[model samples]
Target: MKKPLSNAIKKIILDNIEFSTSHGFPNIVRSESFILKLMWILCLLLSSGYCAYCLTKSFQDYFSYETDTLLRFKRVSQIEFPTITICNKFATDLSRSNEVTELAKSGYIKLKSEFTDLTKFNEFFKRVDYYFKYNSIEYKDRFNFVGFDIDKMLLNCNFNFKECNSSNFKLFFSSTYGLCYQFNADKTNIRKISSPGKKAGLSLELFIGYPSKDYDLYKSYGAHLFIHNSSTIPSSEFEGISLSTGHETDVILSKTYFQKLPKPFSDCAQDSNSSEYIHSDLYRETIKLFGQYDQKSCINLCYHKYIFDECGCYYPDLNINKNLTRICDSDIGFECYSNHSASYRESKICIECIEKCPEECESIKYSLQISHANYPTPFYADFLMTYDALINNGSRNFISYSNVKESTLAVNIYFDDICYSIVEEKPSETIEQLVADIGGFLGLCIGVSILSVVEIFDSILRVILLFFSKRMN
Candidate 1:
């Protein structure tokens, strides 16, 4: 039964195939025109060959098209931080009998009596009797001073000292507060000071060096001569001194896609004749983006301006302290920093400016990291001992070195994946090639030419016009 059913289905398929070939399309198979038959066979063969060629060419073109992306690494200028200095002043002739008296004779210790006075002493030290019992009130106050000199201290260091030449210190301060001063002295001429309100908790940068070479001592004989006086004998002093020299910064470079490519080719290749394909003039574009300022300088200025506008004072970290009367106190600084941060997130002008900032021709994104480590831990201990001795003995002649244990920072820069834009050369068919292809297609399918198509269309239009005229008549 299964065999009979299979045979019946096969018989039906054969009958339909034979009927379609012999009866359904009998005009082509039974025609007597030998030229038409030959033409039909030629057309079929030519069309098949043309289709195969087109498929092969398309595959070849798809695989042969290639694009090359180049990666490049460049080292830009190094960025430096502000330098800090801790200076000490002596009030009496204790330098004559001190172990470090050479430092005083060498002008390391300057007589800065203006920093100490009866009013400041009385205000800081509630004991009024200690001021009178001392020989001279100024001498007693200067020798007994044990805090940072706020009023006379310059926030920016402008002195050109021969001893200190390098400027890479980010933090600077003295261990003892009395008669101690802090200032910035770096290659950058722009100097700034910590906010007055933030004097209590200032971070000191460790000065790395030998202790014996940098330490200085000043003995107040007046305080010792009067045994009944409350002032002590030995006191520590620091003269204009540099703590650390060099710093480290890490810079990492990476690549990103700046412009999008069109399908199968770059936009530049798509319109080679268009001006958009031309390389941008970097100088003109930079001027357009930043006006009169360069990229780095403009960014720095904008940041300073933003800080000043928001906080009512320029940042102490930057180089913009000209004609600025109102310096931001600690309270004002906190509020100003908060407002500036919020503006960065919500301000449209800032966002637009950042977006429009002109990038380099071979643009790369950079990430920076900074770190520091203190050297000669024992020197730091000696500094602390000196500070403690000064606090214990109001006028003790102790040696204090501004050259504390120095800190060294290491910067390591690494590059990641790099990407760049390139105009991909594509194989495009010329006008002649297009014409040949069209002609081949026409001949293969119907043995037709441009004239044949024109004649066929004209004949159809004439017949339609004749019919319309007959109907009108």
Candidate 2:
């Protein structure tokens, strides 16, 4: 039959192999003596097998997607100033806590003793629990109405020697520390500091005032301070730095930038939109409650959602719509807050929240070095007394000149260095690197390359075409 097709194809392949540029294949095809031929054949088989093993290992390493962290230094002429948030340790103003006393007087709730000043927050809660059962008071708004006033707390503010006032600050409510005042919170026109060091940054004289002895439950004295990015919602409860009265506190900060590889290289989320990681239910319900989506805010939202679903009530401190969500009271406290504490500790929803909230592809954080000194020497206290009196409007509660040291604290916040550190993640092996590694192994083991592979494919194509042509003839 016109030379069997299979034999013709095999002969063609053999002819191409004999002249091929590939190292071991041509040596095997050209050998004449039986011993020499066997040697070349063995050599070809070993080289080919080693080459295959190297390439398989190379592919496996690349697919593993290991990453390396790089530490870099950057110097900038100007850096955006961090948001500063201050919360008085004692949340409520004793003078303005008329709501509870008024409710007690209205026969809305029974009190064991006169509802004068809240000695403990539990006393306030215990008093309110009865009234809350009968009334739907907007608890969120209540904090705004009765919480500490910024005008009373901030005695003086100076930024780069420019005068700043309560008007420069925005008010936000903190569950742990009542009303908080935040500076540089407006994102439209962010403040930037071109100079480093204490004098070039922000200076403030704060009056924490006399902490009410009645409500000594928290026992945390003075004001709570936070430094963070402007876009982030301040979580003062966990991140706050304590500022004690009678001390001048200096906070020197260094900025750090983090960048991570996305997708196959890492699990970091690259999107700026918080919705990328935030649950749909949380995004829809609590987007208004928080400014940006981050691990902290996401966790808070997730916690609120779980509490609302499981207990039919939200945390007492959280802001919620009275019409839609019930605020947890003493009655709900046992079943939801206390009894479910362990359940919350072991809940799958909480674990899932952590899984959903991944590290951002790019973010910034500040590292702080804090130092303190006894503030307002006797002479300085005397001089400030006049200014303090003027701002206090001659009220009896105006920080007394004699006790100014006990009520007043000074804060200096500034960048210690103009240069910051950058921490970035890079893939250990890129695609080009992986390819080059495979090429190196191929060349060393069997003298193969891109051209060698192409030559083999070309030979197969030639065989297929010639076989078809002969059949047609």
Best model number under TM-score: 2
Least well predicted 10-residue stretch by lDDT in candidate 1: 221-230
What CA RMSD would you report for each candidate?
A: 21.6, 4.5
Candidates' C-alpha lDDT: 0.35, 0.73
Badly placed stretches (over 4 Å) of model 1 are: 1-69, 72-321, 325-341, 362-374, 377-473
What lDDT tens digits, residue by residue, belong to model 2 across residues 66-108? Answer: 9999999999998888999998876655565587434423443
Ten contiguous residues minimizing lDDT sum, candidate 2? 129-138
Assess the local accuracy of residue 228 in candidate 2 as a C-alpha lDDT between 0 and 100.
Answer: 92
| Residue 149, model 1: Cα distance from true site in angstroms | 17
lDDT of candidate model 2 versus the reference:
0.73
lDDT of 1 by residue, 16-38 (tens): 33333222222335456988767
